[model samples]
Target: MTEALSSLAEAFKNVGVSRAYGTPVKVVGEELIPVALVSFGFGGGGNSEAEGADAAGLESVAGGGGGGFVLPLGVYCRNGSGHVAFRPNMIALIGTLVPLVCAVGFTARGILRTLRR
Candidate 1:
């Protein structure tokens, strides 16, 4: 059980969400697993009109791309003793990559604009 919990914690730590509360670490049969339930929260502090416009822009871009990955960790335990394992959901990975891709795209666009001028 200790080893299983250690392994499960290690996995979550790698993903930078280990600090998130309510993260489940469990053992099933011979497997140690981590499960997470995520819900996005939209803040109201931003300018309402700007927020709406930004949402619209995101919706348009979202339609053109494949839906993002959503990784949910669900640990299942029956009795007590079990192995340690995890299935990584890559939605966060995709979310991370999007900003990187956009940065590259904007840089390329800027270079092109500079060359054209």
Candidate 2:
């Protein structure tokens, strides 16, 4: 199990910002670089048990699993005249920020109550 987790960690070390940036594609004299949000997780578990009267001792089991997701966040585009701009996907932005906003709101509420007390 340890070895499995170690390999998973090593594999993830290669996942960086480069993975979020797609190859630039040019269309109608405009270059567009698609961007994304990438996320992944890994887990492993092991179990050991003593064998019943027949086998005396020793049984072991191990399991590991991993999954990942990529979400399109939008693109950076440059026109023929070299004017560059970024366009974001509103749905992804909202999905990513909702939790953060809630956390901030909760912290602010706590601070306000503490100050009032």
The residue pairs found clashing in candidate 1 are 29-82, 30-82, 30-83, 31-83, 32-83, 32-84, 35-73, 35-74, 69-91, 71-89
Model 1 residue 25 CA deviation in Å: 3.2
- Residue 31: error of model 2 in Å? 1.3
Candidate 1 per-residue lDDT over residues 1-117, each given as its tens digit: 345455555654544345222444443434334555543322112233454677576422211111223345444433453434444457755766799999999999999999999
Worst 10 residues of 1 by lDDT: 59-68
TM-score between model 1 and native: 0.32
lDDT of 2 by residue, 1-117 (tens): 777778888888888888999999998999999999899887888777634633755477778888999999999999988999999999999998999999999999999999999
Report the lDDT of model 1 for residue 19.
Answer: 28
Model 1, stretches more than 4 Å misplaced?
A: 1-24, 27-30, 33-87
Query: Cα deviation in Å at residue 57, candidate 1?
Result: 47
If scored against the real structure, what TM-score would every candidate get? 0.32, 0.68
Candidate 2 yields a Cα-based lDDT of 0.88
